[model samples]
Target: MEYNTERTTLKIPEYGRNVQRMVDYCLTIEDAEHRNKVAQSIIDVIGNLNPAIRDAPDYSHKLWDHLFIMSDFKLDVDSPYPIPTAESFVGLPDEVPYPQKSRKFRHYGGVVKTMVKHAIEMEDGEEKEALIYGIAYAMKRNYLKFNKDTVSDSTILTDLDEMSEGKFKTEGIDLPHSKSFNIAPAERNTTAVRKKGNNNNSKKKKRRY
Candidate 1:
């Protein structure tokens, strides 16, 4: 039995050693026409091995590219599609730059921070006050999302003050209504509904008697 340790390293192991062996055999064939036919056959086998991708657009082209890759681009075959280089497979993906400024409140996220910054820069007026109120409401909503437990208006105000670097003041700002965040009403309503249902069933039983 031939162990993988003794065998040559596979370029794309997903295709398996048999597919690799077929690609190696294609490289040995001197006739371009014969090699192309063999490469096509190997691609068909590869498609069968991975049936899911076979239905994808340009999958045949991808299979042909894989055939070249498996042979380390040594296989001299007439391909319908562009022959891919070893660098194409081994090339590093483009670097994605991360945000330089970290969010003070990750729960509120970058949008809330941006809103706070814009509000801080704005001239003191009804519009700025309105924007500040909007930001506060958004922050409160975000806090509730993070914690189902009701968040205090003071907590949101403190966060807004700290995030604005003391540029914004909450001294005159009346804490927004906390009714939306309060889950007690919902629980109370549920209890009331259950009690009403029981009373209705008792009334029906009395009517039946």
Candidate 2:
């Protein structure tokens, strides 16, 4: 799918260089099994890097975030389809760190909003599939999700397997996972009081007989 015209392109030359490095590294691996493993890792790395461009405090620039997300999405490995390149990096302002307090910030927000709009416009298939994979990978690795407990390699592998099968579902949006429904002490106390009130009323009615 074509990216929104308003979103700015990223200025990171190292991103392309890193992709090339990954491609080269993948080519060097001899065994097909090992190569596939490395390829998956590279894909995971790219996926992780994409969201960081937008979410990271350091790379708060909208153009940079949009470019990174698109470039990573366009990168094709082992596909017969042609992969998009840095030359495709278009629609960005020539200046860096766009005037922070200027009207341009509104334009940048519009660009991001448009990108999301286009994402929803995309039909269910390869484009949606790639996005799901990218998002799932990011969620798994993000510190917020696993702050107290570290996610195991086996768990990642299991999720990867589910992803391959197209059964890997996200909570709330795609699939609804069972969430804890704990009753607060105050709520429990309130229920107890209500029950006691009903019991007292019953006792009063019986005494009237």
Candidate 1 stretches with Cα past 4 Å from truth are: 1-3, 91-209
The global Cα lDDT (0 to 1) of model 1 is: 0.64
Error of 1 at 21 (Å): 0.9
- Best lDDT among the predictions, by candidate number: 1
Residue 150 error for model 1, in Å?
A: 76
Per-candidate TM-score against the hidden true structure? 0.41, 0.25
Measured with C-alpha atoms, the lDDT of residue 39 in candidate 2 is 57
lDDT of each residue in 72-188, candidate 1, tens digit only: 787777788877787777652222122223634766755456556656766786546656776687678556545545667788888888888888757776665656545344444
Model 2 lDDT, full chain set: 0.40
Q: Which candidate wins on TM-score? A: 1
Q: What lDDT is reached at residue 107 by model 1?
A: 63
